[model samples]
Target: MSINLEQIDELRKRANVSYEDAKNALEQNEGNLIKSLIYLEKQNKIKPDEKPCNDNTFFKNVKSLIKKGNETKLIIKKNDNVVLNICVTLAVIIAISAAPIVIVGLILAIITNHKIRIVKKNNEDSQVNKIFDKVSVVVNKVTTKINEELKTE
Candidate 1:
């Protein structure tokens, strides 16, 4: 039996099967949509229906990212001495829960000549550390200028 592209596409969308699989199933089932679905199900070609806006997949991706973040450490140092060290996931949680305090603490850390570093698992350097370093340099320059102006007043 001959099957049109529309039938194959409809079956593919409904069963989440590939184009060839859908076309084969439709042809084998005499171009009947319901029978094609059943044929695909029997062949184990049909997968669990995943909607376009799938929340389960979204949550799974978020969980994976958080796991990676927990494996990575955020380190704050001053004078080559470790001042604070915590997992990135926990730091994010704390920052979210206390945004103002986190901002003030970060500003103070920069003002006090502290270094912010991100260390991945296996002690690999993170690219985020470069951004932190640049920001710290800019903030230090501004603070120093402000202090000089205050002293001259």
Candidate 2:
């Protein structure tokens, strides 16, 4: 059956899609009446199968990739400047609490002992950078995929 602008206008009104959108889809299907319907159906931006493409092949791949990221508890984190300050403060608190007896504490306080400082520093941050780095990677990967898809569509 032949489909024309008038018929498309009717369908577009029924579909609640813009005239431009209907026109484009109609043109893209190259005048094939059934193909246009199928295209709209596949997009799920239409009735009959209005449920969006939730578990589509693309999302399934993304979910699998995320699962891989979760296989190890390693996660990158957002760069929050305040977190750095907190890490430094906690390290100092723990160091003071673990201070040896009053005598040794006085000695440690007097000396510029670098070893204890290093240990406290590691404990305070607790690999915050490593986790954030992983998160950033995941975000970039997902963003790249989304951008690529948008470009193609």
Candidate 3:
């Protein structure tokens, strides 16, 4: 088969090889682009492209997120005293493993006027803390109603 300049130029750009090598690979592979790449690879003229986001990269990103979570803290305070302090990651594990217990504890804390705070390592504000603030407002209203009912009874 006859080789054309376009085919040679395309191969050269793809393989990052000289004009002569591209033309030769194209000629040997009968102008097939995929086969020319394989031929150049077999001859060690071009290196294979690395994936931008492979398994290793994914795992690295997960590790980084976990690390950041560990650096953040979940704090429960009662009467201006810290009652419970734990890493955000461990708190999540506990909350997932014992969801009922976590819910009960949160309710009791809310009833007892304990404060829940998510503090980051750098003391920066988090949207999660804002969520907690909103939940606290709702729980406080419910608890106040319950207290009034108990008093009435």
When sorted by lDDT, best at the front, the candidate numbers are 1, 3, 2
> Compared with the true structure, what per-residue lDDT tens digits does model 1 show for residues 1-153?
678898988998899999999988988889999999999999998998765664688888998999999999989999999999999999999999999999999989988889999999999998988999999899999999999999999
Clashes of each: 0, 7, 0
**Candidate 3, superposed: residue stretches over 4 Å from native:** 1-55
Question: What TM-score would you give candidate 1 relative to the actual structure?
Answer: 0.61
Clashes of 1: 0
Per-model TM against the reference: 0.61, 0.26, 0.63
**What clash pairs does model 3 have?**
none
Determine which window of 10 residues in candidate 3 has minimal summed lDDT.
47-56
RMSD (Cα, Å) of candidate 1? Answer: 7.1
Tell me which residue pairs clash in candidate 1: none
Please name the candidate that would achieve the greatest TM-score relative to the true structure. Answer: 3
- TM-score sort, best first: 3, 1, 2
Candidate 2 C-alpha lDDT tens digits along 30-59: 866467767776787565435568658899
